[model samples]
Target chain A: MLRFIISLWASKLCLFLFKHTGRERDDRPGILALRLCPNFLDRVKKPPLVVAVTGTNGKTTISNLVSNILNLEGKKVAYNTWGANYKAGQARCLLDAVSIFNRPTKDAAVVEVDELLSYKTLPWIQPNYVIVTNICRDSIRRNAHQDLIFSRINQGVSKLPNATLILNADDPNSSFLGENNNKRFFAIADQHADVFETNVSDFPVCPKCGTVPVFNYRHYRAIGNFYCPNCGLKSKTGDFIGTKLDFDKREMLVKEKDGEFKYPLVSDTIFNAFNIMAIITLFRTIGYSPEVIAEHIKHIKLPENRVACEDLGKIKMYTFSAKGQNVSAASTVFEYLAKEPSKKELILLLDEHYGDDPNIETITWLYETDFEYLNNENIKKIIVAGQRYLDYKLRLRLAGIPVEKTVCVFDEQTIPDYVSTDGIESIYVLHDVTTVLRAKKIKDKIKEKITNQ
Target chain B: MKIEVLYPELSNLYGDYYNAKYLAMCIPDSQTVFTSNNDKPAFLSEKVDIICMGSMSERNQEFAIKHLMPYKDKIKELVDNGTFFLATGNSFEIFGDHIEDDGKKIECLGAIDFYSKRQMNDRRNCFFLGDFQTEKGEDIKIVGHKSQFSFSHGKATEKPFISVEGGFGINLDSKNEGVHYKNFFGTYILGPFIMLNPQFLKYLLRSMNLNDSLLYEEEINNAYADRLKRLQREGTEFLMGAE
Candidate 1:
C-alpha cells in the first residue's frame, strides 16, 4: 500500500512536470498512472490480440516486427518504441495509447518485456499472446544461474494458458515449452542455410538427466535441434518453424503448421527469423498476411549497425557485431572472414561493462567454435584491449592461439577501432545491452574518423 | 566409464558435488559415485576415479573437523597417487590443516595449502577465474562462481588451472581447482564440467578414448559457441570494465 501511494505520488509528480513544461517523456505518464492506481495495468484496457515478447535476446527486434506487421494491416498498435519494458514503462505506453480524456485503445499492443520483470508484469496484463524470443544464460550477475532463468521463464509462461504462446523452436529449453501445447506456436530454422554459428555449444547439460542432448542443427546462440538420449525427447516440428533461406543471405523461410506451408522472409539469419517469426505468426493469428508483412519491409532495415557499412578510403568497410554476449555475431564474423578473407586488420574493443567482468568467464567457450578451432591461423593481429585486458589475453592464449598473430592493447585509446585514419578496413564489435546514445556516439566517431581522415 | 560423486555432507560442504558433476562431465565414464559425509558410502574404495567434496552443511565453530573424518586418510592417499577430486566451497578447507569458522578451530585433511571459515552468503555467490589443462598439454582458462571461506595456496596453480583475478576470490571459496597429480586434480570448479566447458569434456573423452561421446560435439558446441563468442567479446568489455 505504501509502495502504491509512493508510486501514485511519483506518477503525479511526473504528470505535473509534463503538463507544466510540455516536456513529456516515457516515465512521466507511468508515474501519473501509478498515482491513479498501483494496479493500473491489471485494471487498464487489454486488447484481444495483445502479445508480450520477452527474453535475454531479440526483444526489441521482435517487438518492432510484430508492431510493423500489425500496422501493415492498418491496425492500431499501442507499444513502447523506446524499448521501455519495465512495469512503469508499460504504464507509460498505456498512457500514450489513451487520448487527452484517457481511454484505453489499440487493436494490439505489441510489448517487449524485460526478462527479470516479465513474471511480475504477467499477472497484471495477462497477455493473450506471449512470444519467448530465446533463452541463453543472461544476467547471472544480476539474476541467478541458467536453470533459474529457465525456471523463471517457465513460471511466466505457465501462468498464461488462455494466451497463445509462441516459442523459439531452435532453442532447446525454450522449444521444450511447445511440447505442453497449450495452444503454443514454435519457430525453427531449416538446415540448408549457408549460414551457421561457429560457436554456440558448451551450455551446461540438463541436471534432470545427465545424458547430453542430441542436436539436429544449430542456429547460433544455442538455438537449434536438441533432445536428451535418456529423455527420448528431441525438438519436433513446432507450429511455426523457421528455416533460414541462406546463412549468408539473411533470408528466413517460414513454415507454419508443420511443413504443410512455407513462406519466404526478407530478414536474414535464424536469429532474426526468431524476431520476424514471432511478429508474423501472432499478427497472422490476430489476422495479417505475408503481403502485409512485405509492406513493412519496404521501410524497415535489419537492425542496422550489427553489420553496418562505413566508408574507409576507397575500400567498402563495416563494423561487425562484437562485444555483446552474442555467439551468433562472433560466428558471423568467422563466416564473413572465411567466406571472404580479410587481410586487413580487424579492430575489436572489450569494455569493462561488456566483457571486463571476470564474472564473464563463459567467454572461453569461443575455443569450441569453428572460428578459433578452424582458423587458428588467420589474417592480421587480434587487438586485445579492454578493462580486464588480461582476461581476454588469457582466453585467446588458452585457445592455442598463435601469440604472434595476437596483440594485447590494454588502454582503450590504443585500440585501432577508435580511428580509421590509417585507411584500415576494421570491424569494431559492440555488446547488445547499451545506451543507444553511446552506440550513436561510437557510430558518429567511426563516421568522423573515416570522413574527416 | 562411471564417475563417483559424493555429496560430502560435511566435507561435501556447500554442496560442492555440483563441482564434482562438472568434473564428472570431463571424465569418460557414465557411472559416478556421490556420497556425502553426512551419509558416508561403503563402496568408496572400489575403483572410484573421482571423489567430490562439498563444504560445511551448517555454519558452526567445529565444522571442518566434524565433517572431514570419514575420507580423511583416503583423500590424502588419492591425491598422492593423482586421483581427481573436487573440493569446492568450504570443502576445500576441510581437506586443509585447520579451518577457523567464526570463533572455532576445526582440523582438516591438510591436502593443499588452504583453510576456510564460515561467513555469510558473501562467499556464497561470486564468480572466479581459473584454468584447466588438457591432455594435449594446453592451459584452458575457466570462469565459475563459488561461495565459501576457503583460500588457495598461491594466487594461481598448474596447467588446466590458470591464475584468476578481478573477481570475488577472497578468503571465500578460493577459486582453486586443487592440485593435479597423475590423473588426480582438485579444485572448487562446481557444476557440470562437460556441459559448461566442452574442452574439459573433450579432454576427458580423449583421455578415456571415447570418441563416441563427441557425436553431437559440433552442434552442442555450436550452440555454446554462438553464446560464447558474444560472452568472450562481452567478457573482454566486462573484464575491461567498459560497462
Candidate 2:
C-alpha cells in the first residue's frame, strides 16, 4: 500500500514533469516509474473493450488492423503503433487519449501486449478480445517455448468473463490453443504460399504424441498445414478459409458463414491479414459491419513506419520490425522480405532500447521465419547492426544462414562501410522503435547522397 | 553415410525437424524417423549410419532416460564405435553422465565425456558461425544458431565453438560453422540445420560419393551458390574474416 502511495506520488510527479521535460529523448521518469512498479499495468482502469494482442511476430500490425477496424465500426480507439507496450508506456497512452483525470477516451482500447507481459497482466485488464497472432519459438532465453507462451496467453484471456479468443488456424501452436472450450475464433492464410513468414523458434512435435509433423507446405516459420504423422492430429485446417491475399492493393477479402467482405491490409503481409481477420471476426461478433471497416481502413495507418520503396541501384527498404517479444515486428520483417523474390537485401537491426528488458528470450521467434524462402536470387545478404548485434546474428545463424554469409557491425559508425555508394540501389532496413530515429539518420545520409547524384 | 537423427526433447530449440531434414538431404536417400520424448530403445536398428537428435525440456530428458535405461549398453556400444550421433541444446547434455536442473541431478545416458548444467544466464544464441570443409577439400563455413550449453571441461577434451559469453551455447545455433565430430556431428543450428545450409548437404553428398548416384540439379546447386554469395556480399552476417 505504501508503495502504491509512493507510486501515486510519483505518477503525479511524472504528470507534472511531463510538461517540463523539453526535447529530452531519454525516458528517465518512465524508466524509474517502470522499475519502481513492475506491475504498472494494474494501475490503468479497465476499458470497455480491452483487447490484448500477442505473438512472436505480428502483434503490432494486428493491433493497428484491429484498432482501425473498430474505428470503422464507429468506435473510437487509442493504441500504439510504434510498439510502445510496456505498462507505464501503455499508461501514458491511456493518459494521452483520455483526460488528465483518467477518464476513458475512445470507445475501445486495442492494446498491443508484449509477448512476455501478455501472460503477466492481461488478467488485470480482463480484455474483451484476446488475439494471439501465433506462437512460434521466441525468447527461449527468458521463457519457455510456444506451448508455454500459448498456455500463458490463454490463461490471461480466459480470465476475462466471456472474452473471445482469436487465433491463427494455420499455426500449429496458435491453433492448438483453440482446442479449449472457450469462445474461440480462428483465421488463416487462404493459401499455403504465404506472403509473410511465420516466426519460428523451435520445431514442435505433438505434445500428446511425439511425432514429427508433415507440413503439406510451409507458409512462414512454423505455421502451415501440419499433421503429426504419428498422432494423425498434425493439422485439420483444410476447409478453414480466410481472406484472399492481394499484396498489390493491400486489401483483405474475408468471407464468413453469413456474408463475405473485404478488409484492407494495413500492410502487405498475409500474417498481418491474419490478425486483421481476427480483428474483423471480433468486430463482427461485437456487432460491426464490413462497410464501416472499409471506411476505417481508408484513413487508419498507425503502422506508419512502413515506408514506400526507393530505387537506389537495387531496391532497399528502410523499415522497422519488432525486437524482444514483439512478434508483430517480426511479422512486419517477414512481410517485407517475403514480398518479392527475396531480391531486396535486408539490414535488420534489433535494438534492446525498444524495451527495458531486451532479453533475447522474447526475440527467439527468429527461427519461425523462412530465411531460405526469402533467399531468392535477388536477396543479397542480411546485415545485423546496433547495440544487440550478436543477438540478431545468433538468430540469423540459427535460421540456417552460413556464418560466412552474415555480417555484424556493433559500432554505429561502421554501418556506412558496407553501403555501396551506387551498386545495389536499394536498402531494406528494419529498426526497433527506439532506434528508428538513429536508423533514419543513417538513411538520411544515404538519401542525401542519392538525391545529390 | 546413413545418418541417424535423434530428436531429443531437449535439443529441439529451433524446429529440430529442419535439422533432421537437412541431414537426410545430405545423406544417401536417408530415411528420417521420429522418436517419442520417452522412446529410447537399445539395439534398435543397425540401419542408422548417422544419428540426429532434437531438443527437449528437462522433464522430457528424464522421460527419455527413464525409458533408455534398458538400451543403455547398446547406446554405449554405438557411442564407442563412433556410430555417429548429432545432438543439440540440452539433448547432448543428456548423452553425458547427468544434467543438473533446479539443483536436482537427472541421470543421462552417460555417453559423452561430460555433464551439462542448464542455467538461465547461459544463452548459446539462436544463430552462429561455423567453418568446415567440403568433399572436394574446399574450405566452407556455416551460419546458424541454437543452444549448446554444458561444457566438457576437459572431460572429452573437445575444443570450444569459437567462443561466446555464456558457456558454449544453450540456444540452437552455433557461433561457428559445423558441428564437428568424427562423423558424429551435433549442432544447435535451427531449421533442423541442414535445410538452412544446403551447401552443407551438397558437400556431404559429394563427401559420401553419393553424387554419382544422386541427381544434382543445376537449379538447386546454383541457387545454393547464389544464396551464399548474396549473403556474403549484401547480407550483414558473415563468417569472422568475411566480416
Candidate 3:
C-alpha cells in the first residue's frame, strides 16, 4: 500500500512538472509509474465510464470522435490525442484523469489501446465499453499475422465479462471475439462499390465448419456481408447498420433497433465512415441521443496533416500519409487514388524512411500492396523516389505498369525534377506515416515547381 | 515449364509468394499454377518443374497439413526423385515431423525427421546472412529476413541448407539456417529472397536448367549490394527479439 501511494504521488509530481515544463503529452510519468508500481493501473482510481477503442486502423480517429462528442455534451473526457497508444501512454492518460490523491475527477475516459498490447493494458484499465474497429494485416515483424492480433485482443476482451463489446460485423476475424460476452455489432450496408481484387485478405475460414464463407456483398479486402453454406455462421446487422452513404452531401443514415437516424459523415473515405459509425454506436449505447451526437460530429473533422490538400493554381496536390508496413491501408489508399477521374501524377514517398539507418526495413509489404492501381491511364507519371526506388520500379513493372510511364530517381530531392505536370490536373503525394514532415517539404518543392512553370 | 504454388491463398504471408512470381518472370513462358486450399495441388497429378509454398497463419497451417496428409507418400517420392521444392517461412514446418505448440503436439506431414516448436507469444525477427553454394561451385551470399514464431529441430541439420554467417539458423545455437537435401530448399527466411539476392536467383535458375538471364538485373544487383553492406556494418544488430 505504501509503495502504491508513493508511486502515485511520484507520478503525479512528474505529471505536474511535465505540464509546467510544456511536456504534458510525454509518457515519461507513466513509464516511471509502471516501473515503480507494476500494477499502477489496477491500483489507481479510474473514471466512472471507461471506454477502450482498439483496432488496426481507425482507433485513433474513433477515440478522438468519442472524446470530442462527450466534451461537446459538457462531459469531461480524457483520451490520448497524440500517437502514443501503448501501455505507457494509456497509463499516463489514466493518471492525468485522477487527482493527486488517486481519486477520479473526470466524467469519463476514452482510451485508444494498441491491439497487440491490449491484452496487457485492458485488464488493468477495466473499461466499461470495448469497441473493436477492425483487424487487418499489420507490420509482419511486429504483429506477425492477424490471427495473433485477434488472439491477443480476444484474450484481453474475454477477461472483462461485465464490459460490453461494440464490434464491426463485416470483419470476420474480430466479430467473434467472446461468445458469452455482450456483443453489439455494427456494419455498413453495401454501397455496391467495385470489389477490389488483390493478393491480400485475412477473413479466415468459418470457425465452426472449417469452410470459406460466401460474401453476399463484398467490400474492399474481406469486409462485407458474409455467410457460410456449410455452417450457420453469418454476418448480422445486430444493433446498428449504416446505410445510404452520400459523399457529396456528407451524410449517412444509420438504422437502429428503434428507428433510422441520419448522421453527418465526418470524412468521405469509407474507412472514415466506419469510424464515424463506430463512434455513433458507442455514444448511442451510452444513452446519447442521435441528434446530439450528429450535431457534435459535424464540428469534428480529421486532422489537417492526415489528408492535406493544396490548390497549386493549375493542378491540385493531395498530400496524405499512408501506413508503410500495413498492406491493407496502402491497398485502400491505392484503390481510392485509382477511382479518381482526374488525370493525376503520383509522387511516391512511401518507402520506409530508415533504409539508410542501421535497422533494415522489410519490403515484403510492397508485394502485398496493390501498386497495380497506379497503372491506370488516368495516372500519368509515377515518380518513384527514395532508397527503395529500384524495388518500387520492379514491383510496378511486375504490376504491368509501362516502363515509359515510370520514372525512378535515386535521390529523394530529385523527385520533383522527375515529376511532370504535362497532361495532369492533379498530383497525389502518398507518403509513409513516419515521413510526413519530409512529405510536406517535398509537397512545397512540387508546389514551387508548378507555380514557377 | 510449369511451376506449382501450393495454397497461395493461405501460404501468401509476408509477401514470400513473390519468390515464385520472380522466378516466373525470370523464366518466361512458364506456366504458374496457384493452388488454393479448396483445390487439389497441381503437383499431385502433374510433374511440375518447381513446387513452392510460403508461410501462413497457424490455423491455416492445420488446414494445409490436413490437405497434404493423404499425399505424404507422394511428397516423399517427389523428394527422392530430386524434384525442386522451395518452402519459405513456417510452411517449412508443414513438411516436418510435428510442431510442439504450447504443450500440444500438432502432427505434420513427417516427410522429414525434424520437429518445430512454436513460441506463441514470442516472435523472432532477425536479418539472415548466409552462404549458398551454386551449381557452378561458386559461393554466393544469401540475404533475407526471418519473422517467424517457430523453429525446426532435428538431424536435418546434418544436411544444413545455408551455412549461417551472421543471423541465427534453425535456432539460436545452430549455425545451419535451413534444410537442403536433393533439390528441396526450406528456410524460415521470409520476403522475396530471390528478388533480394540476384546471384542466388541466378544460381537457382541455372540449376533448374533455364537461362540465367534476370529482369532488372542491374537494379536488383545494386539493391543487393546496398543491403549487404548495411547488414554487414559494425554494430548492426542482427537479432531483433527480446531475450
Candidate 4:
C-alpha cells in the first residue's frame, strides 16, 4: 500500500513537471509510475467495464469512437486519445482514470494498445472486451509479417479467460480467432469492386487448406468475402452488417439484430465503415440499445490531423497521415488520391522514421505499396522528400510513372520549393506517423508559397 | 522464356515478388508462371528459364517444405543442370537441411548442407551491403534489406554466394552469406534483391542469356549508389538490433 502511494505521488509529480515544461505528457508519467512501482498496473482498481482496441490499423480511430459514443451515452470514460497506444501510454491512461487514492473515477475505460505490447498490457488490465481490427502486413523490420503479429495477439488474448473477442469477418486471419472463443464479428457487405490479382495480399492460401481461397468480392488488398472451395471454409456472417454506403451524405446503414439503423459515417473509405461496425457491435453486445448508439453516432468526431484539408486561395492543399512502414495503408491513401478528378501535385514524406539521427533503412515496403496509383495522368508532378527520396523515385519510375513527372528532394525541409503550384488544383501532402510535424510545416510552406504566388 | 515463380501466394511476403516482377519488366516478352502451393511447380513439367521464390511466414515455411518435399529429386536435377534460381529471405531456408522451431524439427529439402533454426523471439533485421563477384572478375555491389526470424548454421559444402561487407551474414558468426550452388542463388536479403541491385540484376540477366540492358538503368543505379553511400556513412549505427 505504501509502495502504491509513493508510486502514485511520483507519477503525479512527473505529470505536473511535464505539463509545466510544456511537453506532451503522453508516456513519461506512465513510464515513471511503472518504474517506481513495477506492478503498478496490477494494483490499480480497474473500471467496471474495461475494453481494449488493438490491431495493425484503425485501433486509434476505433478506440476514440468508443470513448466518444460512451461519453454521449452520459457515461464517464477514460481513453488514450493522444495516439499513445503502447504499454507506457496505457499505464498513463489508467492513471488518469483514477483518483489520487487510486480508486476508479470513470464508469468504463476504452484503451488503445499496440499489437506487439499486448502481452505486456492485457494480462494486467484483463479487459472485459477485446476488439481486434483486421491484421495485415506491417513494418518489415518491426513486424516482419502478419503471422508473427497474429501469434503475439493470440498469445495475449489467451491470457484473458472471460474476455469477448470482437473481430473483423472480412479478414480470415483475424476472424479465425473466434473459432473457440466468445466472439462477435463485424463486416461490410460486398461493394462489388473489381476483383483482380494482387501480389500484396497477405492471405493467398486458405488457412484450412493449401489451395488458394476464392474471393466472392475483394474490397481491397485481402479484406473481403472469401471462401476456400477445396475445404469449404468461408467467412461467417457478421453480427453487424454495414451496407448502403452513401459517401456524399457521409452516412451508412448498419443492420443489427433489431432492424436497421443509420450510422453517421466517419469517413468515405471502406476501412472507416468497418471501424464503425466494430464499435457498434461492441456497444450492442454490451446490451446498449440501437437507438442510443445511433443518437451518439451523430455527434462522433474523428481524431484530427489524420486527414486534413486547407484552402490556399486558388490552391486546395490536403494532408493525409499515412502510416509509415505499412504498404497497405499507403496504397489505400494513394488510391484515394487517384480517384480525385482534379489536376494535382503530390508530396510523399513516407520515411518510416525521422529525427536528427533517424535510422530509417528498410525500403522493402515501398515495393509492396502500389505506387502505380500515382501514375495517373492527372497527377502532373510528384515531389519525393526525406532520406529515402532516391528509393521512392526509383520505385515510382519502376511503377510506370514517367521519369519527367518525378522529382527527388533529399531534405524534407526543401519540399515546398520543389512543389509546383502552377495550374495544379490541389497539392496532396502524404506523411507518415513519425513525420506529422514535418508534414504540417511542409503544408504551411506550401500554403505560404501559394499565397505569395 | 518462362520465369516460374514457386508458390507466389504463400511466398510473396516482404514484397520480394518484385524481384521476379522487376526481372520480367527488364525482359518484357518473358512468360511468368505464378504457381500456387497446392499445384505442382511449373519447373517440374516444363522448361523454366528462371525460378524464383520469396519470403513467407514461419508456418507457411513448414507448409512450403512439405509441398516441395515430393519433388526433391526434381529440384536437385534443376540445380544440377544449372537452371537459374533465386530464393530470397526465408524461402532459402526451405532448401536447407532442416528448420527447428520451438524444439520441433521439420526436415527441409536438404539441398544444402546447412540447417536453419527459427528464433521466434529474436528476429534479426538489418541493411545488407555486400559485393558479388561475377565470373569475369567484376565486383557488383549488392544492397538490400534482411528481416528474418531464423538464420542458417553449419559449413557450406561449396562457396557462399556473397561476402558480407556490412551487416550480419548467413548467421551471426560468419561473414559469408547464402549459398551459391551451381546457378542456384539463395540469399537472406529481401528488398526485391534485383530492384535495388541493378548491377547484380545485369549479371543475372546475362546469365539467363537475356539482354544485359536493365530497365530504368539510370534510376536504379542511382538508387543503389545512394543506398551504398548511406550504408557506408552510417555504418553499424544504422543497423537494426535483433530483439
The TM-score of the first chain in every model comes to 0.79, 0.77, 0.95, 0.94
Top DockQ model = 4
Per-residue CA lDDT of model 2 for A154-201, tens digit only, reads 666656667767766777776666444355555554374744334343
Show the colliding residue pairs in model 4: none
Q: Which stretches of candidate 1 lie over 4 Å from their true place?
A: A1-38, A99-102, A178-181, A189-208, A247-252, A257-267, A304-307, A311-314, A319-345, A354-379, A417-426, A435-443, B1-243
- Candidate 2 CAPRI grade: incorrect
| Residue-level lDDT tens digits of model 1 in A1-453 | 555545544554665577589565457678567656878777666665677888766777777666766676687888766577887778876655544433546777877777766667876777888888766543323333334445556777777768777776666666655335365566565564445433343233433343445566665545667776666766656666665455355455666653433444544445566666666676556655656554565556555534466655564455554433344345544555544544444545534243333434433223223345324333455565554454445445544456666666645444436343343444443434442334445556556666765
Native contacts kept, each candidate: 0.03, 0.07, 0.46, 0.61
- What DockQ class does candidate 4 belong to? medium
Local accuracy of candidate 3 as per-residue lDDT tens digits, A217-336? 866788888898777798866588897899989999999988999999976788888888888888899888999889999988786556788888778998876777888888888888
Please write out the lDDT profile of model 2 over residues B76-163, one tens digit for every residue: 7787776757665456565667767659777777666655566533434433544555435565555454543343332443443323
Report how far residue A89 has shifted in candidate 2, in Å: 2.4
Q: Which stretches of candidate 4 lie over 4 Å from their true place?
A: A19-24, A194-197, A353-358, A421-423
Quote each prediction's TM-score: 0.64, 0.68, 0.96, 0.95
Q: Which candidate has the top score in lDDT?
A: 3
Ten-residue stretch with the least lDDT total in model 1 chain A: A362-371
* Tens digit of per-residue lDDT, candidate 4, span B53-90: 99888888777888999999888788788998999988
What's the lDDT for all of these models? 0.53, 0.56, 0.84, 0.83
